[model samples]
Target chain A: MTSAASSPIEFYFDFSSPYGYLAARIIDAEAAELGRKVTWRPFLLGAVMKQTKAEPLLTIPIKGDYARHDLARAARYYDIPFVVPPQFPFASIAACRAFYWLNGTDPAKARDFALFLYERAFLAGKDISKPDSVLEAASDAGLDAAAMALALQDPAIKELLKAEVDKAIKKGVFGSPFFLVDGEPFWGHDRIAEVREWLRKGGW
Target chain B: MTSAASSPIEFYFDFSSPYGYLAARIIDAEAAELGRKVTWRPFLLGAVMKQTKAEPLLTIPIKGDYARHDLARAARYYDIPFVVPPQFPFASIAACRAFYWLNGTDPAKARDFALFLYERAFLAGKDISKPDSVLEAASDAGLDAAAMALALQDPAIKELLKAEVDKAIKKGVFGSPFFLVDGEPFWGHDRIAEVREWLRKGGW
Candidate 1:
């Protein structure tokens, strides 16, 4: 774990993971405390699952049940307000594409976009799978909503998002929020501490 | 999932997962109640992680913290004894290989062996990783202890164990205890209800 406060930390995420939402709630705050910059990478979870040929989180019986309960418990533990959205697993494709756009143009704006979507879906209980919700989110981030809307339809951006999903698959990521501080992959939201420690030690 | 009582239901397992132990306790009884047979497959969770690139239960933050409390709650819910074994995940290579021996020879005996190991290690506080303890377990199951001890050393049996682990990786299995009937995978011990329902429907 590196103690260098200015180090960069990458967070690969999707809206499908409740723990991702939980992690997002405090990750920015935690990183700020450690004086680290977080790089948000929005990737399609469904595409990643397909490439990895892994079952969705909902398929894991014991873990799935515990996830719902634990998510509520975690929100309380962290003193954050939470609500389960009706259309969960809101189509993450658009959000992922927006992230793809941000990856090239304005990366920090991408981080804000991720947090906006997370808070909307997990805390504010908004349906984020729709394009309009994403547009509203883009507007909230001070980005041109209409321009971002048009960019979402671009096949190249879709392929770009798909390529990142493919990259994550090659790296052996089956789920999110998958975190890699240096070279080591710390999977799931619960692994942030280890990731923080790794960063604290300069990812040795 | 199939309701054909004569046909066995697949039992997917990993040695490191304590919930697998808890599920092993009642799966056979539940299957018997439904007049179905169980086919036990011993798979390596670590190998699955290597294949799918998912983290272990302990490595995942939220899942890890909740697992301790959840396991205790599950024990109470099932009215079963649970001791959280001293060296958890007391390497199941020996136990898994032994299952290979008993699987073909006597599947019922294999089920008994799994239960004994789970009860001893997780409930009675026994170190099942030891050779002597395994021999005792074999003897308790009415198997010849000396012959079983010798059989445990067979390279062919070790290969069989390896094959099961390899097969699990291909099957998109990430954890235990996964239950598959036909092509559908019902992961975790708590998933038995869905497995039972699917069995009632004849197949999934």
Candidate 2:
């Protein structure tokens, strides 16, 4: 097992996942307290779900109602304002591509861009799936809107996002807010407490 | 909202669910502390899963591995001994029918029988799904073995179990360890904390 001091926690998530948005809100602060760094890797969960033949949580029968309530309940618990987007389960390709495009230059800015987009989609209930909305989030994060638009079309940036999704599948990451701590995979935002405990005890 | 003082918490579960086993371990004590009575209702999750098109946690790709690990990990967290049975996801019809059979006569003893069967299946790694195993658990729970054998074949007992499953589906209980406090529904073992808070505050 890698020592916590040297190994960063790998947080894998999809741009459109509400649980991913919730994890993004707290993982950094939680990790920092433990003197651990976290690497935010945004990938397309739609691609992963397609390969796994997994149904969306809202599409499942009884779980659909419970999940809808839990999503809002969790947001309330975390004191984050959440409104389900009108175009939910929307294509996150544009947002993810923008993240990679900005990440290629400044990783910090990419993180900010990700947070900005999540806030727009989940908090403000905007349709971040659109290229215009993504560009707006990028601009709000202090990224040049015109440069971001061009970068969105960059073949390398698109490939980077695709490669990330491929890597996630290869690593058996099938859910949003999936975390890898010293090669131990913890899925779902509910496992955050267990993640913290795992980091504290160095695995049990 | 139904007052907590008058409403008993409805605990709905399937015998084959590991998470249900974990919840069964502590829900009683947790509820008793708050002066609340718990009604343990066993239903066929298979029927519910069929309607939901939900795969068993161990059958879903990527999630299967995480679920296996989380099952053991959660057991450790709760200080409950758990061993996945060799014949996992075993047919729970016999065990569930036995529960309703015993429940019709004695609710408290039925709870004991449910716990007894869960221990046999999960903690002791026994195949409680088998009639012989169910008979053994029933006998251990102070039930007459010959009578349990007869009850297992009784058409009314079989219909009773089927009715419970139908009722669960109608109530939108798609997952194991589903809890109903008043009219509000909560699913999963992780929601116990929220259940406690809901009881404490009456409602959010």
Candidate 3:
């Protein structure tokens, strides 16, 4: 296992996950406090679910109701603006492809673009599933809209995202807002406190 | 919705769940702080999972590994002892039936019996899935062994437990360690903080 002090925390998430958005909001700051760098990894949750045969959270029986309430309550807990987009559980293929395209060139700028897209879809209540909206969010985040539009359709860029999703599945990341701190995996945004403690104590 | 002050905090759980054991360790104390009562309702997780088509946490791919780690980590966080039994995802129908039998006669004693059974299974690393083990745990909890032995086979006692499981499903409980505070559902041991906050602020 890599030492916590030397390794960058790997944060795997999907654009369409509310919990993923919540984790994206605070993970950088949380890692910064421990003098750790976080690598923002955007993958497709739908692909992971397909492999796991897991149903969408909103489609499950009792869990669906609790998840809906918890998603909004979690937003309130974090004091972040949130509204469920009308077209939720919508396809995030375009948003994810755009992220990988930008991340390949400028990782920091890609992270900014990710936050921008998350805000548009979750906070501002926009349908980021649309390529046009994704391009708009990309442009707002200071990426060239024309370049992003082209990259979104690039077969190579699409393959990169697919490869990342495959890698994530191999790493046993079956859910969004998953974090790997020096090979230790933590799932869910609620586990941030435990993650912090893990980083602090290395391992218990 | 029932008032938080008057309504008992309903803790729904399956005896075989490690998370349920962890929650059982602290829920009463947490509720006591708010001058609230806790109704320890032990239901079969297998029943809920059947209705939701939800696989046991330990049966899922990546989630299973994380759950094993989290169960132990959560125990350490709460300063409680935990040991995963060799036969995990073990049947808890016997334990549940035993609980209802005792709960029908003495609710307080039933809670004690539940805890005793949990300690035997989780902390002591014993198999309480067997009727003999359930009866032994009940005897250890200061209950009459003969009565419990007879009650364990009673059709009326068996039906009572089944009825509780049905009621839990109808009430939208799809997981162990589920909490209902004034009719608001909170799932997982991780949500205990939210449960406490909800009790304190009476819902936000």
Candidate 4:
């Protein structure tokens, strides 16, 4: 619980979930207020899903219904816009690879892309599976659409994402937006505020 | 969502936790009023721990602190007696096996034993790992202490307990007092009310 030499908070997220998007948006402000650094560790949620042999959020009958309820309540609580995606379970592989490439060039730009994609998927019901939709999100993030398209095709980006996903799974992370502060796992978006409170108290 | 085919909400619990004791004392009353049968399924919390590689409740630094705060608040909220146990991480294996054996003969007695053990372990600060303490709890449940002692020697009880643990893991159970009504797993004693509400809605 020492205050000195605190490790940066790592946020693991994906573009497919609106909750991840919402968490990513608020995490930086929350960490900054607590005098902590946030490391936006972008990993493929799809990869983690495949590795864990867990059903997708939308597939779990009770949780799926709860997710809808959660979004409505969360949006009202946070004063954010939320619209249900018509064609959910959007293919996030391309968008995730783009994030891997963005991790090298500009982390802020990558975060912006994530936020933009999240807004489109959950706010406007945009079809994120379409390459055009992904390209548009990159453009909104202030990245060159052509450059992002090229980076999305790069084998290195795929490899990096695969490695990150493997590492997360090995660390016993079974869900998204898992915030690791000083080696302690604070799981789920619901735990974000609590993690900040812990950081403020200089507790790991 | 059919009311006619409503199955009794099955609650799987271990007697080691104060939360389980609280739930055991009140759950039957809640279910009975709703015209739903409450099935008590006792399994070794230790066995579930081994399968999931979960640490003891006292070992989880953050959760340990939270439990102390949460349990007291819960006790007061539910108006239940809850004194923290002096020797936690007590072996719930024997208690679990006793329930497994009694499920064949008398589930009502098994439920009573579970409630008695929770009260003794948490309220009385008793070391439930001791053979005499367990025998006393079983005796309090209106069972013959001699027969309960002999049943503890049966290898079949151990196998039955292990199978329950195995079945729990297979069903994606990761915590104690898991309620499965119509195949939906609602975890923790805190979730008992939610289970009742879900059952009332006649949906799994």
Candidate 5:
């Protein structure tokens, strides 16, 4: 194993995840404040859930109902604006491909693009499940939409995300908004406080 | 609907749940600070999971490993010493019965009994899954040992716990450390901060 200090804090998330969007809004700033850097990796949670036979949050019996209400309360707790999309938990493959494509050259812009897509789907109640819709939003946000559209269909980009998901699963990330400071895993948006403690105290 | 202010916070937990025990360690003091009362209800989460076809935390694939590390980290985060007993996730029926019996007479003493039993199993790493062990813990904690043994076998006490499980399921309580403020549901120990906000702001 390599020295843990060299490993940057990695954030694995899905675009369609409301809590993931909530975490994206603040995690970058939190890391900066803690004098650390974070790498954003968008992975397919549905793919991982499928292997585990796990149901989506909205489909769980009572937990689903609580999550729906908790999302709003948690959003308020973080002082962030959030509105569920018309088609929630939509296929985020297109968004993931776009992020990976942009991330190839401009990682910061990819992050900005990721935030914009999250805002479009969550903040403005837009559906980003389809390629055309994703492209439209990216274009409006002043991104290279044509390249993103091409990247969405690229088989290489498809494999890239597949590999990332495989690696994330290997790292034992089964939930969204999951953070890894070195090899230490922290799951959920709620663990951000605990994440801060880990950063300050350097693991407990 | 009843007056929201009049309805006290309810905490539903199982003695076998580590997260439940962790939350139990603090929910009381937090409620006191908010000038509110909390009721502790111990029900069988196993019963709830049976109907839902949900796997236990340690049984899930990647989530299981993450939960293992998260438990120790969470325990440290809460500043509570927790040790998973020899047989983790053992039946909490005896503990539930003991709690219900004590709750019928002295509610405060019932809470004390609950904490003592939690500490016994989690801190001392003792198995309280059996009636004998639970009775021993209660007796050692200055509770009525002889009477509690009889109560543990009482047909009425058995029915009481069954009814509590059924009623908890009806209230959409499916997880350990599940909290309800007035009629609003908050699941998980992580949501305690949100619970405090809920109590202070009165449904925001």
Candidate 6:
């Protein structure tokens, strides 16, 4: 069974991550079905990647081709319309900063903004890696575009994203689409099913 | 809903792989339920790792910690008894050569030998990386101990494994526990469920 006091699902994701986009589109409903809420945390995977000394998935020879195929297949499996951005592994720093900036006060709007940025990169082929694009997404989500543009360049907002990534790394999150529920860590988009199981059973 | 012409599920695995061992213990039963057979193909991951330039999973920093945790959690998920070998990442070349040596003529015996070898390494923490261990496992599986011992040193057997690994690479099999069914590729032990679904539905 579930309780009202169960911790919110801490969904740590990078906007540039394709699997993160796929999981992002479904995690909330999975959480909601269990009477749980998910707190979306957008962090830069590049910083975490450096700590791991791992190359981008698509840059790693044979695995790259497999990842390319798997990503498309996984999207179809979830019925999510998808596309690789022209700059596939482009930086999501701007998007992350913008997310944490709003996350500080309007977390709901921040979550909505994060989804838009993901759809921009994955579904619409727009460049959310650009501050202008982030600001446009905020506007499209019915938020203040000009204020968001200023927030994107704000040093305080940049520091917010950095601190969130560091916190995620400290919390043992080294991948996009990582989840923390009941203080247990689950990684990868595939783990979403397991996450639902964990939520429904509390812990198994 | 079923076809007798279905191809065998091509299960490519590395002897030293954790997930591969996990999948090896269950892939046959999964195939059997679908009125299909499984072909256990073992290969050396070290060569594949060299080509991909990827570091071992447990050697990476933050991700390493996550992998160690996930491996145990996944074993629990499948309800399979598991313990990491003390000499994890040990050489599996000998075990692999012996497998192919028997697989050439007596495939069923080779499959049984593979299961014993896997249990020895993962369940009993036996040093299957050794030729002596390979001989002992073959004997334990009711296979010819002397022939398998000589098979370990046979240049012909080594070439068999080499050819198989080369063919696996060409077929885009870079990960352990990779599956090719219906001419579709699925990587990772987690895909076993998807494989069963694919067999039942033919595809999504």
Which regions of candidate 6 are displaced past 4 Å?
Answer: A1-5, B1-5
Clashing pairs in 5: none
Q: Sorted by TM-score, highest first, which candidate order results?
A: 6, 2, 3, 5, 4, 1
Rate residue A102 of model 5 by lDDT.
89
Tell me the RMSD of model 2 versus the true structure: 2.4
Count of backbone clashes for each model?
Answer: 12, 0, 0, 0, 0, 0
The per-candidate TM-score of the B chain, in the order shown, comes to 0.87, 0.96, 0.96, 0.89, 0.96, 0.93
lDDT of 2 by residue, A1-204 (tens): 866566888999887898899999998998898788888899888888886677777767778888888888888888878777888788889988988887878888888888888888888888898899888877777779999899889898888888988998888899999998878888888878778888777776
Q: What shift in Å separates residue A28 of candidate 4 from its native position after superposition?
A: 1.2
Error of 2 at A198 (Å): 2.9
Q: Can you give the TM-score per candidate against the true fold?
A: 0.54, 0.92, 0.92, 0.58, 0.90, 0.95
Error of 6 at A159 (Å): 1.8
After best superposition, candidate 4 residue B99: deviation in angstroms? 11
lDDT of 3 by residue, B29-126 (tens): 99998888999999999987876788878878777877887777778878998998889879999999888988987899899889999999899999
Tens digits of per-residue lDDT for model 1, A36-90: 6777776777775554444566445444554575566557657788887887656
Candidate 6 DockQ, CA atoms: 0.70
State the DockQ of every prediction.
0.04, 0.58, 0.58, 0.07, 0.60, 0.70
Off by over 4 Å in 1: A1-133, A136-204, B1-6, B140-142, B202-204
lDDT of 5 by residue, A48-147 (tens): 8976678888768877877888899889878899998878669998889888988989999998999999999889999888899889989999988888
True-contact fraction per candidate equals 0.00, 0.53, 0.50, 0.00, 0.60, 0.62
Q: Model 3 chain B — which ten-residue stretch has the worst lDDT?
A: B134-143
TM-score of chain A of 2: 0.95
The global C-alpha lDDT for each of the candidates, from Candidate 1 onward, is: 0.73, 0.86, 0.88, 0.72, 0.88, 0.85
Local accuracy of candidate 2 as per-residue lDDT tens digits, B71-166 = 888888889999888998889999998889989989998898899889888998888988888998777767798999999999998888888888
Over B133-200, each residue of candidate 4 has an lDDT whose tens digit, in order, gives 78887777677889878878888877787788778666655566677777766666666655666667
Error of 2 at A47 (Å): 1.9
Could you tell me the lDDT of residue A45 within candidate 5? 95
Error of 2 at B7 (Å): 3.1
For model 4 chain A, give the 10-residue run with minimal summed lDDT: A58-67
